[model samples]
Target chain A: MEFEIEKIAQLSRLSLKPEELKKLRKDIESILGYIKTLGDLKTGDIEPTSHVLDLENVFRKDDVTRINIRDEVISRAPCVEGPFFKVPKVVDKE
Target chain B: MEKQLYELTLKEAIDVAKAEGPWEIIRAVIDRTALLNPRLNAFVRFEPEHFLKKSRKSEDFKGVLSGAPLSVKDNICIHGCETTCASKILRGHVPPYDATVIRKLGDAGAFFLGQCNMDEFAFGSSCETSAYGAVKNPWDIERVPGGSSGGSAVAVAADMTIAALGSDTGGSIRQPAALCGVVGLKPTYGRVSRYGLIAFGSSFDQIGPITKTVEDSAILMNLISGFDPHDSTSVNQTVPDYTKALARNVKGLRIGLPKEYFVEGIDPEVETKVREAANVLKQLGAQIKTISLPHTAYAVAVYYIVAVAEASSNLGRFDGVQYGLRAPGKNLLEMYFETRNQGFGEEAKRRILLGNFVLSAGYYEAYYRKGQKVRTLIRKDFEEAFKEVDLILTPTSPTPAFKINEKISDPLAMYLSDIFTIPANLVGIPAMSLPCGFTEKGLPIGVQLMAKPFDEEGIFRAAFALEQEIRIYKRKPKL
Candidate 1:
């Protein structure tokens, strides 16, 4: 059971050291190997349960009741410029 | 006098507070936290001022939990207080608003004791994954208090707090309660609102109580379990006064012992004690019968897939641009890489990667989808078994609390410890761990009682019956 370890880590937004990647590679392989046994069970026609309570499409009144703590929320951000959260540039400047 | 105060259960403590005033109870809890926290490492940060101020103003208050100093697991948000899920990624993230549970606790007049320690992001079965350091079991400082609720359980067991709240994804509350010798209840999923709980496995996580007795757990449950407009998944069922369910005779109750739970890996002492607990329940008028939850064998495998899949998606909120720790890097991608690399611990990284792998393009159908299908079978197993039994009894853990680093390097072995407890979370039912007996080394063992969804009363009635007969509450760790 082999995998593209670096690819998965990149997708996960994690940067692993070389040694850490080596260890994770082994762990993932073993865990995936164990999970393979689940294929033996006959789950034909059985629906998957995503949420236990089976709640669906709940809607509430959309009245814009005043925002109570706009300042407090922005104040807790790691980096904020004025009233908005500051972030790195999403697009590279040409 | 301090020793006597420390020994008081939540109900007993409430009575004392009523007679002498709330300040007396607050001072006793603070004194105990000061003396025991350094050695036990049960708390990451304590807001003594918050508790003190609350107690001072609570002079005229006479609510259900008034004067009780309750510690909370770090994952639950408190306004203006840091709510790091014991992860470096969330080093200084303070929530602007209070979690629904915090608001309810406040309304009930329970004082905020402090932020207790836990596994980072509630990742590990043992509490060793916390960035703050492992919480040592009060019974034996060398052993781990079972976690991610380790600190919460330790605080209650060591008398540092009257009661504490912990989140259960898979046995976080009960396993630690078992290891530390206390009562831990995981209310049915959606029975307690999860609006502010830091999501581990969103479908599996529920915040519940770790306390000194079943009645105290019932009292806390009444306060915490209710429908919240803030949480969509919160059920609309009417919440019962759980204390009223206690002490009802179990004479006609039907108890099922799933053969799958009493398998080879279980410690002999744990098996004997749990079996003996069954016999005691039988003598009290309950009939014991062997039952089969055939799908039990697949629980752990299915849990990891579903939990890690949800966790991967849930943990994505922690990238560099948000409230947690940020790392300096040349570009946006590098910043996300470096920040998460530095912020998350080894176990957190492992799960994130595993989660992404299973949910990734090619593997999604086989791993994540099939795992969900298998989960249905596991839930169906419980649905079928409940027809023949009123409750299911099993060992909370296969063995007692092990030494701190025993299974840290072995993830599979560590995952196996939660085998019995995980099924309850998967099936969305109420279950609890009660101190049943002890090991030769004097470590406490717990027996698990599980009932159908919303039937927490069944669990309490049987646990209270056995607890009355065994008198396990009289014993305490020498700590």
Candidate 2:
């Protein structure tokens, strides 16, 4: 039941303060114990439902107008300057 | 305590206020919202003038929610409006078009209230991750409202908005709705269109209602509960007017109690309250039966794996190149790296990284595929249980609302809050939470109702039955 806050943080990609880590560990361990209940099941043949519809292919007739963005045909660049979508540089390197 | 404006149900207020012309309801809501914003922080964005203008433009003028105010969860896109999903990555990202559901609501003459706050990227179980401040519970300002849809729940509970449309990922909608003592519905996946809902694990996401009463939830459900041609995932099946079904009654409907859900961690008073609701249902003529969802224990782990894996893939669009907020750098990779680094909240980054880690080349089979396999088992559990009964009933969460700092420290604990609600999403079944009863301490408790696939009507009927008996519709938070 030792929740590794650093390990979970590393796994989760959080930059946490030194103060927050101690509290996070205890909370996560209880939660992990709770979620661990899933390990007890014997589920081999059940077909998982990723989507409600078992059917595939939402084919539409070619005549139907579905978002004909101007960029599809008229794409050189809307605001390309020197091989980039130009904007002022943000996020200065510290 | 004496008929707090914060506690008044929208219908009761409607009687008192008399009529809703000139956005009277919205004005009263704004005054209340302004009062609660400092403590509750429910609304992420509120624009009075723009919202009032839209409020006055209701075409039908006599439609179900006409003049009745509604808030959109920040994740759903509104044309010419910001939908950041409480994520910095999409900060200032205004959608070019309205979500199909939004269009339907607009056509039905519902007033537009501001976008409410949520967990960043719809990733958390509590309202702690928004770029804006976390939303607090109306019952207790220091506690977390269960989230990704937490703000939607808070708004409805606090009487800031009559109803809200929130997207459920895992248990985003129902969990918070349970926490805040409101009715939240997660319709069967594909029952509602995902066209305008910003993606967070697309297969598992759905948009539904958070409301003060079962009736409000039903009315809002009728408005947004249709298929859209724009989304391939939207079912081609006809969407029924759910409000009609609310009056059908749940008498003789079989209510199944899964043995596994009742065994552990669930608060005793929550159990008492849930049992109380079950007893009331029994008194009202529904048969209460003990049923087995033998594989029920594995919901959270399986859900986390699939959800994070899908999230990792779905969230890949946030690189610095094409759309949304970007932190520029010399080259694409640096720009991509920097933007994501500064943009996403800690929890969102955690899930994305977990998603990436789970979907990582070597681990995919063990975590992702195995999780999907377990997901099948969880769905099988529900399917089997449903055969023995018409609907399943359970406590919406193992515990009542928790203090703000209670679970923020642990990602796993936050994920656990969605335990009861996740299996419904995994199975693509319709589930809802209604205010069943409260603890002696007065914290609200919620009871969940789940129906077999495409049986949202059964869900409404069942909830309406309990909603009448539980009768918390009249209760208000003291905030």
Best-performing candidate as measured by TM-score = 1
Candidate No. with top lDDT: 1
* Residue lDDT tens for model 1, A1-94: 4479999999999889999999989888888888888988988888898878887887778878776787888878777899887777768888
Interface RMSD for candidate number 2?
A: 5.6
Per-residue error (Å), model 2, residue A27:
11
Tens digit per residue, CA lDDT, model 1, B14-55: 888778766777788889899889999999998879656544
Candidate 1 B-chain TM-score: 0.98
Pairs with backbone N, CA or C atoms under 3 Å apart (clashes), candidate 1:
B251-B285
Q: Give candidate 1 misplaced runs (Cα > 4 Å).
A: B1-3, B53-56
Model 1 chain A, TM-score vs. native? 0.86
For each candidate, report its DockQ versus the true two-chain complex: 0.76, 0.24
Number of clashing pairs per prediction, in order: 1, 4
Q: Model 1's CAPRI class?
A: medium
Could you give candidate 2's per-residue lDDT for residues B301-419 as a string of tens digits?
88777887788778777764555666756755556667776787777766675666666666666567778878777776777887889999999999999998788766787777877
